[model samples]
Target chain A: MLKSAKMVMERARELAAKRRPVVAIAGAEDDDVLRAVSEAVRAGIVGATLVGQEVRIHALLEELGEDRNSFEIVNAENPKAVIALSVELCSSGRAQILMKGKVSTPDLMKAVLSPRAGLKVGKLLSHCAVLEATGYHKLLSITDGGVLSNPDFNDKLAIVENAVHVSRVIGVAEPKVGLLGVMNEPDPDFPSTIEAAAVARSCYVKGMTKYIEGPLTMGTIFRQMPEGATWKSDVVGDADILVAHSIEEANIAVKALINLRGAIFMGVITGAKVPLSLVSRADPPENKLASLALAAVISGASK
Target chain B: MTFQELQTRAQHIRPARMDVVGATPFEISIIEKWEKRGWKVRYREGELEHCLQAAVDAAACGETDLLFCSGADNLKLIRFLDRAVSRDYKPLTMLQGFEVPSYPKVLWVGFTPMARYDSIPDAIKGVSVVAKSMAELGEPEARIALLSCVELISPGVHSTIWEATLAHMSQRGQFGKARVDGPLAFDLAVSPQAVSNKGFKSEIHGQADVVIPPDLNSFCTLTDEIHLTGPHTAVGIVVGGPCPIALPPHRDERHMTLSLQVASLLV
Candidate 1:
């Protein structure tokens, strides 16, 4: 299994050497956006298609000392048009990954989730941020952090499936999915715990993902359950993926590790026809590269 | 403060009477140990619900200064206590204290998902009650961070709206004497470096004494996740009710005992 973000980046660098994928960045006029894209392009990790203000993008590239000829820049001053064109690039198979740049999450999501975008694969689109935090033995994936505000039972299942897909892409063959809830016991009053229990039962029947546990807390996941406990999930303390109940939960958690523990993270939106990288403007350049690399690897492996 | 420090802090006050609703022999021994240390311990046995009610009733009647229990369903105990004590779920804050190795000082947190509320305003009121409870705990001027996924207020995310509102209210001295701010991501709330990196100007300079998680479920998830990545000693106590209700931890026996000890101070 891929243990660290470093390993994933190395694998992506190698894959890019073999066959570089294309990334289409919507609203790609921001310096941070262009910087990361240019770095990826220069490193041969991926080809780029920038969609935004053409003149400003050229100037920013020049100021950043990058050649404008390197990328295919689309001139669209309107934010909606910029988003549509970028999504269109991926939908048309001209690009392998759709990257967010200088766009609010809601704005980008609105465009991608629109029926005209044709990105959804007949299911939900959820965000998965693969993190390798210090003190952790292996990489852990947090899901639905960037998208899917308040997921329902079915939405959560779909979110888990999407995370499982991402987990497998990054080399967790049998991903242990831990559905995060307040307590292990499913109380009727607390619908989240009950949903977690129901999701675990459903996953067992589906048999798509291995080792699904829920209503599991962070502490319990890492602790050993006593013998013959009525509620024991093996995913405790060794979960490869955390299916958060809400987007804010996952987002806050992922960012917590990123900010506090200096956890290296690569975020991607799944359940779409093409993989998506929603790099934050505040994300350091290295993390941006890693997110791009993750997208490259996912799209490359799928191909 | 750390659990050890918490035990010592309890020593500042005189030992108080405690009511144990349900316990095994091992738990009884711990209670006995406390009794020897000048605590007046009362033991009760019966059905879990009945014992819990009796314990609550006794505390309600000023019969016990401290309350601790084991064997009752955690939610059941919390709900029963909230209804029996808090009256309307203003906020029965589960104050968790963590002594993280990587952290400088012990962190205090309130995760209030114990009771249902009518609306967002009701939820914010419940959460603010937790902040008020924490305000009385350790830091007189508690730096309370209303944790959210992002700092920006977006209509799409309900938590952000709640956090922004609470932060605004906090500026107006609404959430007690605690210095409160929010719409802060976890890192920004606790990591000064992140705050600098993001150039987010705020009151919580990565040193929030209390982090009020957006929801109770996330608090459970984050608390356990923190344990996994970095095992830390923690003690949880229920506050802002009629009396301090210490829910027995699902962790090891040490935490359960420490949680009880921590509850002693709340009395």
Candidate 2:
């Protein structure tokens, strides 16, 4: 299992030494996007292919003091064509990783999920936001924070499966997953709590994950657990993944750690033909690079 | 007023009758402690629902000024209290007062265990009760934040739209002497440094006296995370009824003392 987020960066570098993954940046006209992607290429983790207005990409790379010869530039004048060519590169094995640059999430997702020229597989797409909190020993992943707003039973199971895939990509062979809720036991009054319990139990029966348990709270998953508990207290304080009850619940917890605990953050959208790094504009450069590295590692390993 | 100041003020109010339901030794001692402070206290012993019925009936009828109740079923207590009080009073919302060791003033939070607000109207009603309670607590112009995970108002995220609309409404003096703003995150709502660092202009610059989470799940996750990992005290009560209902934040009776002390005078 990966000890920390830094190890993911190191592993990506090692993978690049053997076979570097080619990352295609869609809408690569933004300055922040070029800066972050170039940093990953400079660190020898991934090769670069810029797909956007070629003139703008060249100007940005030049302003950032980067060599133009390092990247294979594709000219797509409009947003539609830019995203299409980027997804096509991944679909045709020309690139293994797809990184979103300076494009709205909905716009980029449209091309990535196109029917004929898309990267979508049968599995549903879900987001996994991995964090390295200041005081924690290992990395923890919170799922469906950016996608799947109000997930039903099957959606949650798929979300967990997607997060498990990301966990394994970071070297964790078997990750303990916790379905979080307000109570550890299913309360009929709270239907979401019952849903969490049902999902956790189904995963356990199918042996879908290493250790799956819930209707657990954040106190059990990430913080302290109550004493004398009967229901699967084994995942307490050692859970590798926390499957949130809703998107808002996951987003709130994710931001709380970032704002309060000073957590190092990186996110990925999985269950696709290839992993996607939907790097946020609000994220710092290091956080954006971390996402790129994670995507590069997952994409490189999948090949 | 801070919780200490609120408690100090409660001690000086004219002695009033209090009805305690499901009184254990711990709850009884809490009542006895208040009784020694020149307040009239009474304990009713029986089944939880029965005592809650009797206490709610008495408080709703002005036979008592404060009702001290405890039970494992928080929803049951709320439903019974609402049904009995709604005959003569409007429905209520629960507001909690927290005095963290590092915080500057009492953080007033509005939330519900059973109330899930997904629309703008439901959300406004929730904040209205908590804001009204803050007005009752000597903060006529309280700064209230409609808390969310992000500050930007996105059409896709329902909570942010509701919060932004409510924040815009606050400009017309809709809340009456209160400055309400949000879609503020936890950090921007509470940390002045975060507000300054983000460089976003807001009505409440991280000195919010009140914060209303968008839903029950966020409420539970955020509050429980803070309570478990931090050293602090909390006092809570249900407001906008005929009388303020004392609902302690913790299972321990020590926290109930301040809640009872504050609710007694607010009634």
> Which candidate number maximizes DockQ?
1
lDDT of 1 by residue, B1-267 (tens): 456666777677687888887787887877787888888988888787777778777877889888886775554566666666645544576777777766677777676656443256665666676666664456557788878777888787787887787789879987677788888888778887667766889898888878877877767666655655665777777876667877755545787778877777667
TM-score of 2: 0.85
DockQ of each: 0.47, 0.33
Candidate 2: residue A200 lDDT (0-100): 93
| Model 1 lDDT tens row, A1-303 | 789988888888888888889999999898888899999898788999999999999899999999899999899989878988888898888999998888776788777788887887837888899998887789889887887777788888788888899889888889998887776768787888888899988986788686998777666665666345776566976889988888777887887677546789899888888888877656878899989988998998888
lDDT of 2 by residue, A1-303 (tens): 667779889988888999999989998998878888899989899998999999989898899899999999999999888888898999999999988886777888777777786578836889999998766678889888787766789998889989988888887888989888877778887787899989999988877776888888776666666666655466888888988887777876776666544577889999888888886555667788888888988887788
TM-score of chain A of each: 0.94, 0.96
How much of the real interface does each model capture, measured as fnat? 0.53, 0.27
Separately for all candidates shown, the number of backbone clashes (residues 3 or more apart, or on different chains) is 6, 0
TM-score of each: 0.87, 0.85
The reply for model 2, stretches above 4 Å from the true place, is: A38-44, A61-72, A134-137, A220-232, A284-286, B1-17, B27-31, B73-84, B87-91, B97-108, B119-121, B138-141, B147-165, B181-209, B229-235, B251-267
The prediction achieving the highest TM-score against the true structure is: 1
Candidate 1: the clashing residue pairs are A218-B224, A218-B225, A219-B224, A221-A236, A221-A237, A222-A237
